[model samples]
Every structure is written in structure tokens, then in C-alpha cells.
Target: MRFATWAGGAGVVSDAGLHPLPSGVSVLDLVCSGLPAALEAGSSALAGPPVPLASVRLLAPLTPPTVRDYVAFEEHVEGVRKSIDGVGGVPPEWYRAPTFYFTNPYAVVGPFDDVPVPPGSERFDFELEVALVVGRDGTSLAPGDVDIFGYTIMNDWSARDLQAREMKVGLGPAKGKDSATTLGPWLVTADELEPYRDADGFLALDLRVSVNDTLVGQDLLSNMGWPFEELVAYASRGTWVRAGDVLGSGTCGNGGCLAELWGRGHDVPPLVPGDVVEMTVEGIGTIRNRVVSGVDLPPVQAARPRPRIRRRDV
Candidate 1:
């Protein structure tokens, strides 16, 4: 069963219709309630008649309590690093553990919406990724004990120019990433993927991305160097992971932005206003978005060297 939350309330999508969750309750609320029965009930029928999928304005299924995005594919990391610096080697610690950063959850957007290109950014881009929604609170949860409620398509929108400038300072990708993140046509429950679970314990799915209908790249979920479960365990190592938190598997190889593509001599143009990006993850579904222009609040201008530091004494 697939679940989604819109302006009105949360609901499950079945062959019949989009069945609503109990009044005033949301997918976030249901997850936070931490009741297995509540989650189970999402797939069952409801009292009222269902709504047509086309009628509702779907929001990001849940307003995440927090979002932790991890880089799980070595190929993706290597591709980016090689593009930026002409180098290739997995960081020593990457094989030992997963690494991630917290990003703004407030900027999340639904699948069928327009994403604003952050101002002063000409190198805007999209990252094709898979996201896992945590459903239980567990402190230092063992990998075996980790509970993955569902999966969804994630487009971690980026401002490459800003990201490059900030990384030089060794402190932020914050503003570079805060503008928007697109998630979901709907959430596909874990049980729905049971058939595709591989022996190595990773879900195997074909993920492909396109811009303006031209295929850019594709990667299999099994290509991930670090599986999702291990990342969840690392996330819970010393903290409480609550329901409604989103854990992302970072961009798949060849599934990243023009920054890496251009760096490698690919002729792709950077994303701009009027471009449409569509990503399809087998089973989960496709999420498409149109890029639109946006203006920065305080208005900014390119920095100019202040007359060259008038010089010094004899």
C-alpha cells in the first residue's frame, strides 16, 4: 500500500481510492504515535469514501522531525570527487562507517510541484536518491532491530556554485542545500519491496533520471557500497531516532548534477528555469518537477576587489 499526506489529511492509496486517515491526524502523527496497529491500519479500509488521486494536492508525505542524508554509494562519491579534483579513492573510513549531514526539513516539497532555483545560483542541480523513513524511536538501535517504515523517491536539489564556495570554508553546505528537497508521489511501504530484497540485504531496484526526456543516467540500488540498514544503525548509535525522520541514500552514480557531469567534460547544461527533471525508481515511483526562478531576499551583487589594497610604506 502507498500512503500520502495532502493539505486535508493523510491517506492510503489502493485500487479503490485514496482512503483518508482519521480526522486531524497526519502521517507524521501516526508514525509518532509509535503504534504498530496504526501503521498496519494504513493499508486497511476506512469508513468514508475515498478521494481520487488527482484531486488532492500532495505535500511531502510527512513534515519530517529531522532529515539525515548519507552518502552511501562509493561510485557516486568517487564520481563527484573525480569531477572536482581528478581523483578517485574511497575515504578509508567510508568502508568502516557511514557519514552524513543534517539538512533542512522545512524546505521539503511534494513530487508534483515546482522547485525554486535558489537566487545567485546559476549552477543549480538535482540529486537522484532513495529515501527511507524511520518509524520507531530507538537509541543505538542495532541494525537488526532498525525499523524502516517505507521508501520514497528523493530529489536533493542543489546550488552547486554556493556549495563549492561554502566547502572552501570547511563549514557549510547549509545554505547551498536549504532551498528545496522534493519527495514522493507517495510512500511505498517496506513490505511492498519484500520480493526485491537481495541476498546482500539491499533492495535491488532500477533507478533512472532524465531531464527534458533525455536519459542522463541509471543505477541499480544494489550498487550501493553501504547498505541502508548500516546507516540507520550508525544514525542511532548515540541518539534517539524518532518516527517521521527521513534518512536518505545519497545520489547514485551517474545520478548527480551537472557539476560532476561538466567537470568530467560532459556537455550537459546546468539546470535552469523551465527545465523539467523526472526520476523513476522502480517500484517506488517517479517524481517530476519543474524548475522556476526565485529572488534572494536582500539582493546580492558579485563581490569586487576593493581598489587593490593601497599599499605600503617604504
Candidate 2:
């Protein structure tokens, strides 16, 4: 079943119709509601009459309790690293396990929402990714026991200039990434995606990104080197992975932004105040957003104290 969070409440897309779920129900409620049983019951129950699609506003379909975005594609890793410096190569640890980081869960943007540019951000970019949602909370889950709730398209908006500066300090991609993350069109449950799974358990979906109707990047979901099972398993090693947690399967191969593109000498037009970005996944639908310019940035002329360096014995 395809589930969505709309203006009224949570709902299911079944029999090719949009049916309202229990009143006051939200996607977060479903995530925490014992996924396997909830889904089974929801699917078995009689759904309410179809709601007019146009009348409903689609939100992110989820307000996850926590978000962990992983870099699982070697090509994306190499491209990102290569873009920063002249050379690029995947790190050895990447092959040993899945690598990820925490991002702002409250900063999520839904389909059709307007994404504002961070003031003074000269290099804004888009990343095409696949995101997963956790259904039941579990810790130290075996790979086979990692039950995923659903899937969606994730557009990880980026500020290249700020990211490059911060990452050099060996600390963050924090302020650079925390501003916005676009999710939706709607979520397709894992049961619905069963047919697309390969023998190795990876979904072979066509993921793409477009700007103003022009295609920029495309890749198969099967291109990923690490299975999400490892990601989940690793995430649960020491801490509990609660229900409603969101995980992203980083950018696909050739699914790059203006930074990687520019590094390769493509020199595409940069994002401005009103450009539209669309991300689409085969069964999950698309999330389209417009760039809204930001205002009231701190003045560049503000003075700051200089750092004092410590002397070392020669």
C-alpha cells in the first residue's frame, strides 16, 4: 500500500484511489504503530471513499524521529572528493562498512514546497538520492531482521562553498546541509516494492533529477555497492534505531550537482531565486520545488577577533 500524509490526515493509496486513514492519523503515527501489524491491518480494512487528489496537499509524508544519510555509492564518493580536490578515490573504510551522518530532521521540505536559498550561498546544488524509513524500533538487528517501512525520493540540497570550507576543518558538512532536504511526491511501502528487488536485495529503480525539464543525472538503484541492510545493521550496533528514523542512500553514480559538474568542466547555469528542481523515482513519484531567495543575512563587514596560535618548541 502507498501511504501519504496530506492536509487532512494520513491516508492510503489503494485500488488506484486515495483513501483517508483513521482520523487524526499521521505518517509518524503509522511508523511508531508496530509497522508489520499496522500495515497488515490497514491493508485488510475497508478504506474510506476516495478523496479528490487536487484538494489534498501532499506533505513530506513523514516527520521522522531521526535522520541518517549514508554515502554508499563509490562513484558519488569519488566524484564528491574529486570535485573538492584534483584527485578522488573511495576510502578503504567505506568497503568495510556503511558510512553515514546525522542531519536535521526538522528541516525537511515536502513536495511543491518552496526551498529558500541560504543568504550569501553562491553555489547551491541538488543531489538525487533514495531514502528509506524505519518501521519498528530495534537494536542490534540482524541484516535480515532490518524491516524497512517504505521508500521515497530525497533531494539533499547543498551549499558547496560553505561545505568545502567546513569539511576542510575535518568536522562538518553541517550548516552547509542543514538548511533543507526535500522528500516526497509520496511514500511507497516496502511490500509494494517487493517485485523490484534483486536477488541481492537491492531495488533496481530508475532514479533521476531534472532542472527546468532538462535531465541532468540518471542511475539505477542497483548501482549501490553497499546494501541498506549493512547501513541499518551498523546504525543499530550501539544505539536503538527507533521507528520513524529516516535513512538516505546517498547520491547515485553520475547523480551529481553543479559542483561535480563544474569540476568536470560542464559549467552549467547555477541555481537562482526561481529555478525548479525535480527528483523522480520509478514507483515513488516526484518531488518538484522552486528556489526561493533568502534575506537578512549578517553583514559581511562584521569584524571578528583573530585566533592566537600556540608556539611549539623547535
- TM-scores of the models, in the given order? 0.91, 0.91
Please write out the lDDT profile of model 1 over residues 1-314, one tens digit for every residue.
68888878788877677899878878777666654665677746455689988888888878898998888888777666665445666678877878888999989999989998998888898999999989788899888998888889999998877887777788767888999999897888788887888999988999999999999978898888777878788999988888878999988887555655765667778898999999999998888999998876665566897887688878
At residue 33, candidate 2 shows an lDDT of 78
RMSD per candidate (Å) reads 4.1, 3.6
Give stretches of model 1 more than 4 Å off. Answer: 43-47, 84-88, 296-314
Q: List per-prediction Cα lDDT, in the order shown.
A: 0.83, 0.81
- lDDT digits (tens) for residues 1-314 of candidate 2: 67777776777766555677777777778777766766865675434577766777888888888888988888788777777656667778778888888999998988889999876788888888888898778899998999788888898888877888778889878878888998887778887887988998889999888898889988888889877777788899988998889999988877556666766667687788889998888978888999988775884664578767688769
Clash-forming residue pairs, model 1 = none
Number of residue pairs clashing in candidate 2, backbone atoms closer than 3 angstroms, sequence gap of 3 or more or interchain: 0
